[model samples]
Target: MKKWLLTTSAVVMMGSAIPIAWAGDGLWRHVPSTHAHSSARAVAGGPFAGHADVQHDWQLRSSVRVSRQVLREAYLASRAVYTEKLQKYAKVTPSQAKKAIAQAHPGMKVEDVQLRNIRTDLVYTGLAQDDEERYLVIVDAGNGKLLLDRLLPTHHERVFSGD
Candidate 1:
């Protein structure tokens, strides 16, 4: 009876310990890549070069499972393509960009303005202060023509917030 009691206690203790170990392991498990394009190169040597590392740290800190590859692509694209397009296409001053955003989102202040090159279109993405919305004002960089004005999805508030 004494031996059987000791064996049962050991089994119970081992079972409980397994779950604790599994839980710890689960925290560090590799997250699957989200982007379909696996050929995308890892970003290096630019203003946004360390973006992947920063994103990894943020993922670990927040316990979020965001794909590192997606972050790397964004940095690579922005540095390699978007920045150049902005300088070439954007004839308007930052204040003018802000004014355009304000006009669209009436009663809301423009918090930030960033130029983006989405495919072939050059756009000014403006953040609104009140609802944390992003307004995409498409502009022709070649001739300074305003193309499209629209609001992106609401969830992008987190993206614009830099969180």
Candidate 2:
């Protein structure tokens, strides 16, 4: 009985230790890390500042490869264009576009609104309702004109069927 009890305890301890060792190894193994010792070797801007292939081997190992400042500058530039176009056109507010989309869809609700520049025209794209019931409502960015308002799947169906 004494020998059997000792062997059972040893087996249980081994099983628990196996899982604990695995958990500990996984905790640190998958975590993203960078080994950059200093900023002296950082990439300088020309045209390929954030290209994945241009990044160092150490940087490629980590999730992020591009400079945050570069991304911020691009975002600010796009926002400036969005603001300038909205103010200059004075055609439709996002709220107005939402209302128009809601009216057309009856029970559906507008989930998101985005301003897109297609050629010289500013278009408002509103995603309405859920994923399955979603509709893509495109309106003139400057005049509140409904250019294209169709169910998302219907649009895909037409394209796939070569309609």
Candidate 3:
């Protein structure tokens, strides 16, 4: 009986240890750390400054190795806050923002102009005509800056395909 009890206790201990080891090694391993400086690169916020149609240019090498217009009129949706002194900095009406974008591009259409409370800095996803079909432009709200414009990758279609 003594030997049996000792064996049973040993088995119980081993069983508990197994679960602990599994938890430490397999299940709960590799959690997302919130440390500031873990040397991890910051995740890119959706291809835009996330504010307005801020314009920026970047050079891209063509398949033939020649430089070409890779991006243009990238739009981002952002929240714009106008402090007490800068009333112009205050809130730009949606119509006002639309006019600004049109004046910049001259006959460019703004698509998906969603005004949310959080990203209210005048950043938005806009549609524009370029070399490709429809460019999802990242526009800056405050200054109507075109941050980036490019052909969206085909990978997005897969996500919408319902696999």
Q: Which candidate's TM-score is highest?
A: 2
Per TM-score, what order, best first? Answer: 2, 1, 3
lDDT of each: 0.54, 0.62, 0.45
Best by lDDT: 2
**All candidates: TM-score:** 0.36, 0.46, 0.29
lDDT of 2: 0.62
Model 2 worst lDDT run, 10 consecutive residues: 51-60
The order by descending lDDT is 2, 1, 3
- The true-versus-predicted C-alpha distance at residue 146 of model 1, in Å, is 5.6
Candidate with the larger TM-score of 2 and 3 = 2
**34-118 in candidate 1: lDDT tens per residue?**
5443213223442223323222111324464447685555445444453654575567665676676677668876675666667
lDDT of 2 by residue, 27-145 (tens): 22333325453223334542223432223322225464557685555555555555665655657887887778888788877876777667867778887776458778887867787
Cα error, residue 48 of model 3, in Å, equals 34
Question: Which run of 10 residues does model 3 get worst, by summed lDDT?
Answer: 70-79
Give the better candidate number (1 or 2) by TM-score: 2
